[model samples]
Target: MWQNLDYVSERRADTVMVLSGDHIYKMDYRPLLAYHQEKEADVTIAVMNVPVEETHRFGILTVNRQGRVVEFTEKPKERDKGTLANMGIYAFRAGVLHECLPRYAQQYSDLDFGHHVIPTMIAEGYRLYAYRFDGYWVDVGTIQAYWETSMALLDPDSPLQLYDRAWVVHTRSYERPPAKLGPQARVARSMICNGCIVRGRVERSVLGPGVYVSPGAVVRESVVMNDTWVGPGAVLDRVIVDKQVVVGAGVQLGCGNDVGVPNTTYGDHLRTGITVVGKAAHIPPNIRIGRNVVVHPHVDEEDFVSYGDEVPSGETI
Candidate 1:
């Protein structure tokens, strides 16, 4: 890992920090690096304590009381043995990175850091410190977890508050003004972002950039992503619309009435029949999409009778 880093370091003259894309976490690495330099450790890994049920999915770390790492195991069954688990965020000294990567490259012949590099460094008796992270860390790797995590942003008591000006969560900017609520709009317990024109009833839902809810449309407990158009009188419940999708007039995305009939188009991914519409997808006019159905991307078709069937429109589906 270090040798290739050395090569890249020469090409680009700046410090590099490795971050994992899967987890929704905010960590301040400046303090960790300062501590690393103060302690003069070879490597410093950020660690957080997750619930026992979730430990099997993460790399667990055992550290002594003095904050020294003693052992590292990947996905241990018994999480009770160690409370500290790796957060996959690292801060390495440039010299240490140079020394570690070449040796790692020779053994593994690949540039995978977690699999071979970190473990070998720990075994080599280099001083390693555990930087404890006490903030909110949500690994939204699954569909259910992703939905829940996004909703958590609306909670007042949520630990991960994106609205905090001091530690703001950043996303790409959209070319739109502040979200507008039309005279006919009735919104309760919902989050509406910029460029959205809401003219209907939105409850417990998240409307992303450029979403247009026509008059009399009712959206409840659903997530509508960027540039989605919810037609007039449409009723959506527990649905997840990806970027640039469109729902036709009076369409029902989830099961609001009967229970025995199943909406198999949503598949078994949804534990509680939450529907998901893929990016830039389109639904036909007056279609009833049953509970937990997932509509794929770039579909632009009309007059669909069944649930879970991908829309035939090649551009909007």
Candidate 2:
């Protein structure tokens, strides 16, 4: 926040709002700003009630009955702290923030809001208050979390209502033609974005713009990105294919059931039974890719020839 001091001052802004891009949710900041003014708070931190078991994943807050923040713990392993998790949304009094942050920057090398700023401000008797927000917010920082959140959009009763015209969600999009489906195409419970051409079976998957599913191919429980081509007789299951990739004819991606095997290169990150094909990678014809496998970015068909038609589970190409 201190880094933008000059810009904020240039704009003559009174209250500065900080938000996290990785989180997906709908909110109106007008009410929050109003609450901050009404409470005459120096900093208003938005918080939500998360599950006690999941408290370790967030910055827990202890607020009094008056909703003034008393304590702040960032990503605590122990859940003894309250379940009021920080949503990383803040409305700060610009004048107070401008004066306070620079002094702290001189003291701390790695200054973070949850770890440094909020905790120190509370200790110093700053008028930091908690704004309770009961809304659907998700931090999709990891691959599993991203996939789960995307899948949640398929639910009819999902709290994250993208269909709510009152609060519309805007996204970056490209100019593309209408999505087409061949006579043989069979789709069920899936999202086919504009410019996609489906000629085979797509079940419970999300196909991005301009994706092409060829005849006799099957895409199941996967997320295929923009302009990717699924060739004839290929099958993709529980996989994530990145942009502008090609799956050669008769290739079987994410085929095996060895979900227990972690990725050899990224054991901690890619061990959740998800095969990730990086951007612009090519899968060779008649090749079989296993669970937890990672096809690195820009890996070409010639690279797959070295694997001899089968990329084993837990391997990184």
In TM-score terms, candidate 2 sits at: 0.97
Model 1: ten consecutive residues of lowest lDDT: 308-317
Tens digits of per-residue lDDT, candidate 1, 215-289, equal 989999888988899999888887788988788888776754432333454334554556678887778767776
| Total backbone clashes of candidate 2, pairs 3 or more residues apart or in separate chains | 0
The number of the candidate with the highest lDDT is 2
What overall lDDT goes with each candidate model?
A: 0.75, 0.91
How much is the lDDT of residue 220 in candidate 1? 92
Q: Which stretches of candidate 2 lie over 4 Å from their true place?
A: none
Clash pairs, candidate 2, are none
